[model samples]
Target: MSVRTIAVKYGVHRGTIPTFVLRSGGKLRSTGLNNERRASAAILYRDGHTLQEVADRLGIDPKTVRNAVVAEGISPRPRGRRPMAI
Candidate 1:
């Protein structure tokens, strides 16, 4: 049964259903917010957007985007001055 259904049937808050199920040893299936954010950041990065660009697009800090990329096993691009062609 869905959390919304349970919530409606029992007059319980929908957010608390996951906790109740877990306490009862039932597994709750869903992609976590952090994981979803990380995946989104990674995709934007992979699509050639810079960390700051991705951060701006996602309304998060560049440092957070960098951390998300790193946590996803992706190597972050080096910071500092870009080399100019001679």
Candidate 2:
């Protein structure tokens, strides 16, 4: 489907469509899906849960969890290990 068709179907401006895929050969990820997942992660994270724990609960990768958190402008705490002090 063309970008214009997708925009009209989704009731969004044609110019608002995304331009990148998650990976070169992978199917293009849905902007709506990303938004929904990000919102879900934010709610869970705000309620006090680690990224790995959230990823497990959401059945997604820790990286995707982190991406969602970042996309929402939330700075999720570092997972696994702490950085060394200088």
Candidate 3:
């Protein structure tokens, strides 16, 4: 669960959750896209979807999608428009 979720559930402030977790020897998880989201982003990018397109579809930031794509070992297409065929 996200820090925000834990905070809301326990009626604690979001900022304090991380501190408490660490003090208790609990490791904090990384935020942003998870493994499933990463896989979906990779599939969409591989299918020719642009970073923005994938982000829109997944409700995430384009930069996040780009990072996920790169981490998946897929080469992202060059930015801007694609060339038109005659």
Clash number for every model?
Answer: 0, 0, 0
Off by over 4 Å in 2: 1-33, 80-86
Q: Worst 10-residue stretch by lDDT in candidate 1? A: 77-86
**Candidate 3 deviates by what RMSD?**
5.5
lDDT of 1 by residue, 1-86 (tens): 88999999999999999998999999986532388889999888867788888899999888889888888888876775232445
Q: How good is model 1 by TM-score?
A: 0.53
- Tens digit of per-residue lDDT, candidate 3, span 1-86: 88889899999999999999899999987766889889999998887778898899999899999899889998777897533445
**TM agreement with the true structure for every prediction:** 0.53, 0.52, 0.60
Model 3 lDDT at residue 21? 88
lDDT of 2 by residue, 2-84 (tens): 67788899898876665422244436545323677789997787667777888999988878887888878888665654335
| Preferred candidate (TM-score higher): 2 or 3 | 3
Greater lDDT among 1 and 3 belongs to: 3
lDDT of 1 at 51: 86
- Clashing residue pairs in candidate 1 are none
